[model samples]
Target chain A: MTVPPGRRERKKAATRQKIAGTALRLFLERGYDAVGIREVAAEADVAVTTLFSHFASKEALVFEQDEDFEQRLTQAVTGRAPHEPLIPALRREIQALVRHCTADSAAPIWRMIDESPALRKYEESMRLRHAETLATAIAADPELSQTATASRTIARFVIDAYSLAREAADPEAAVDEIFRMIEAAWEVTCPSRRA
Target chain B: MTVPPGRRERKKAATRQKIAGTALRLFLERGYDAVGIREVAAEADVAVTTLFSHFASKEALVFEQDEDFEQRLTQAVTGRAPHEPLIPALRREIQALVRHCTADSAAPIWRMIDESPALRKYEESMRLRHAETLATAIAADPELSQTATASRTIARFVIDAYSLAREAADPEAAVDEIFRMIEAAWEVTCPSRRA
Candidate 1:
């Protein structure tokens, strides 16, 4: 899916981010309902039609940040260190977040999404999609499909724990707190789950 | 919130279940959107107004059975065996459901819910509320909130795992599989997680 490193793709990506950034700022400053699509389009310097081309609806535009962590998760679980069980690999992923925190990252998006029920519901739907991606990825493996439910269940738990931590912490501390909680859950599930 | 177990409350409960049973049978046999609320009211032998009294939406009438589990979960988590950790206690509660499985119980309900996106979204929202309820209960324990994020994160993970196990099982074997995955996750987190 990687577009070749060229101006067209880069410009498209930047325009997409611009619309998102503008939309988020407007939603935060006023409210999700207070802002209109035309305003966002104008602010982002894209035509309204172009903005809608990038996103199906205002809800989709607001929820654009809900990315495929499941893809990263699939990467984490499938690309584990030799002999490592899925749980430990996931535990390490959660822990790494705590060791390094990024404030100008996805936190504001989550914060804004959390503030609105429509957005929260959209994100929850997105969460189901993410879980499916995880389950589907695991189910694809010959050794994983039959046994994958358990691993996927554990993955869901890790992801859920990671979510709660990310939501509750101050941005600077979100990563570490998130990782610490996941590691604790990891310990409870895999008593020997190590860093 | 406990209504006194008098004739009126019992009668109301019976009426509610009857409406739900009627709606579910209709939703499964007919497409959820294909059937109208008037048809459901007619079949349930209740006025449309009466059916609406019991459920906020037709969706609620079809999903009435699910609301009880979260109430039970909140009760169970708050009142676990004195010696057990929260996750194992939660696992045992799910384990208890195996005995409740029947040829005419939750299996059909689960199947119907799985097939609909609206229902799936509704169920996830319900699960988040359940997680929040359990989190609030756990947070009340002074020792937990003092730690800031770990306790709430653990509550959400445990709830997520419970939700996963519930959704992933074979219909006939769902109860057993859910608890089994739960116990497995518990063991992975806590090697000694036991009955």
Candidate 2:
């Protein structure tokens, strides 16, 4: 039951995509450090203010999917099928994210991020923000019955799983292995779930 | 057996301490962002090169104990009492660290770190590096016999405990609560420990 975006919204979305695509192309061609926001805006045929309006900073441009990534994580908790276990839902989402980022097409962008101190720092703080958002969503679910501490702890662990799996030699296997540990951790918080 | 440092080594240590103390004072007096590296060196009465030699960056001065922190975590694993369970040993170490950072004396330093984006990012990366070193120490213990993934996952959970607890309302209690989850996570990886 969602309304379709009107023309104005559609145009704005298109502009954002074009700017992000153009910025990524320029960053990859030249070094991230070498490229300026002005250059990105000029090459994208947008004003400097327009670029800033869409993205908060140069680092934000590189992490074009930051908001989407955060939303997906929280939704995995809030949008799961009723009574389905929490850790598995989170594991499935993390597995998908690891796959998306580790795909061959995404290699160059990650390499560029790893090489830039600015980008790496931005990504770390971005992950912390996502973890906090996920914690809030988890705490809001009455059925989960987690204490504030438990909710925050589980959220951080889920975020850690995604990050650690992404860097592992085998991302899929790493997700399963880490999720087993998370499942055990989660279950310990539920005394009723134990024999 | 431990030997005291020679005079030259003692002098080098004193110089390093003076530079770090001076830098921290300036960073606190002026905002971290307002203070510059050259100003720190000048105030400390060291050549710019001498300051650079002792500390890698402005951020490094803020985290002067980074190496010591990493070493202590690794030593918690590699130098534990024989037959001591891994999770408890790590829990003890993490508790100590949380207490150290949460002390009233350390509040200003941590406040400075939280207020500065550069310092926060630096701390995140430093935590990751410490986790890796702890993982290596855990994996190398023949008695533990964990897979590489398990060792790494546990290492991250321990590091997360320290961080989450440091920010919690009751830091000491948070450390204990998170360690309970970590203990459960670690036990799952050790099939032999269960009936």
Candidate 3:
């Protein structure tokens, strides 16, 4: 059982959401490069220091769900049903993520990211970090019995599936195609588990 | 047959090499972020415009071999001996690249890159571009006859092998191990080619 957040925690969450929502609106309205942090803070009714407290940098504001995204990926490995196969779990998660990102609502945000070098660079490094975290989670699973290199490689391949699928003409089909490859790659690492 | 360059081209090539060497030496000594473009041009005894012509950005100075690297990856696909298998050819090229980047002489340059977020981001994007070129080469090959998605997925896996191997404790072994997985992944896309 989980304890619900206290009042203080709830207020902090509200503040962060407001800041992020305001920043995204400003960025989309005028252009990511045109907007300034001070302007975002002013418009959000938060101090510059408060904005910094919430997000590490302007790039961080644009990727407000960075931590959440990382956590979901890791959890998809660690929190799956007992005896659930790893590749399928990851495939489901990636499919959902591709759906979320490719939804019509997210098009403008991704367009902004593709157009701006700063955002693209930031997203690249962010994905690398997520891949590393996922690697650690995969390595820690005793049931998988994969070598360190295998674990890391599969993690990167899964992350690549997400990235590649997002850009494909048919994101869902791309995920399925890529996961079929990943499933084969994973089975090779554990010959005993081959069906 | 390849023809030798004329005098004008030879002179241009020499100037480009000199500028790259000078900039690298300075970056290694004084640090990549601390050195200015003007300082590098002055030290190389070329105008700022000439330096810019040779390298598009300061990050480009550190990665002078970027174009060469991209070309070599694509060539590994396009220029392989007739009837040579695809996975092993890519494995050999990636093995060579990992060796080049992991050499003692290349340690300091990679260290500098790891220390700077900007350089890490630049390298990430550069690798993406190389992956796309590789995918295109693979898709254009009549013998492979892979779906565009499979070609692209395998291209990313090959690039990931290079990157993950570079950071591994035993880069050569890492390359071999990762390629085993890639070989399996590739075979699944071309079931007819499976042994």
Candidate 4:
């Protein structure tokens, strides 16, 4: 995927980042609904059409982050240490967020999602899609899928745990705690997880 | 605080059931958006205002069965065996849905919900509300709440598991599998329950 690096590509990338940052700032300052798309465009120093070009819609400002969340989780799943299971890799990703986001202003992005109905709707549906993807992955696994029915339940339960953890006041500790709980539940269901 | 054995209560119950049953039949036969208030009333042999008295909106008709769902789950929590943990009881109540709904009709209902963004919105919000109720109940339990943040994790995981079971294709194994998952998840999170 060579980009044939050029000024246009660099500028286009910059515009997306700029618009996203501006939209996030505006949304955090004045709740999601109170802020208008026009204001966001103006604040980002872009025309309305430019803003729309960057983010199709205002909701996309929030939803874009959500869409990326599952991708990152999937990356962790695929790139796990050979000895580690999927949950351990997932725990690292969430706990990493607790450190990185809290130190930055990105924490409000999560709060915005928790507070906004539209955003929550987008987030929940996106997680369902992620769970579905994980189900496909689990289904491909010869051992797990044989016993677990396509891994839909396991994937959904894990996503639900993560969603609840995201709502926690402390995402890092919450991640560790949730992953541990899920492990226990898995053990009870499979009994051999304790081993 | 028992109801006096009288016509009013009986009539009210009959009216409520009539409206719900009629709405389900119509929605099942003609699709949710195809029918209207006037049509529902005519089909139920009731006036428009009478229909309104029973169900505030069409969405309520779709979710009317959940009143009993929430109530029964809450009662299961409150009257749970003192020694039995909340997660197992929650598991049983969730598994019980299999005996009733059987995932046979789940695809249509899910399709109806998925097709109409409004129903999906309604169902998500309703689930959030149920999580809140379960959280409050879990919070009140000195034993469970004190151990760790049992309330939120328990509620969310149980719900995630139930949703998984409901969406599963096999009625025979879904509930048993999901319940096993939830209980196992709870044990992992709760120190006392962990192996």
Best candidate, TM-score: 3
lDDT tens digits, residue span A95-178, model 2 = 999999999999999999989988987888899899999999999987778888889999999998988888889999999999
Clashing pairs in 3: none
lDDT by residue (B62-142, candidate 2, tens digit) is 999898999999999989998888888988888898899999999999999999988998999888889889999999998
Candidate whose DockQ is highest: 3
Please give the C-alpha DockQ score of model 1: 0.31
Write model 3 residue lDDT over A104-158, tens digit each, in one string: 9999999999999889888988998999999999999977888889999999999
lDDT of 1 by residue, A45-118 (tens): 98999998899778888767456455676787677766665555665665554333235675566567778777
A110 in model 4: Cα distance from truth in Å?
Answer: 3.4
Write the number of the candidate with greater lDDT, choosing between 2 and 4: 2
Error (Å) of candidate 3 at residue B63 is: 0.5
* Model 2, residue A26: C-alpha shift (Å): 2.1
**Candidate 3, residue B146: how far the Cα is off, in Å:** 1.1
TM-score of each: 0.69, 0.91, 0.91, 0.76
Q: How high is the TM-score of chain B in model 4?
A: 0.79
lDDT of 3 by residue, B60-81 (tens): 9899988889999988989999
Candidate 4: give the clashing pairs.
A181-B189, A184-B184, A185-B184, A185-B185
Q: Who is ahead in DockQ, 2 or 3?
A: 3
Task: Check candidate 1 and list the clashing pairs.
Answer: A98-A175, A98-A176, A187-B189, A188-B189, A188-B190, A189-B188, A189-B189, A189-B190, A190-B188, A190-B189
Q: lDDT per prediction?
A: 0.66, 0.91, 0.92, 0.71
Residue pairs clashing in model 2 are: none
Clashes of each: 10, 0, 0, 4
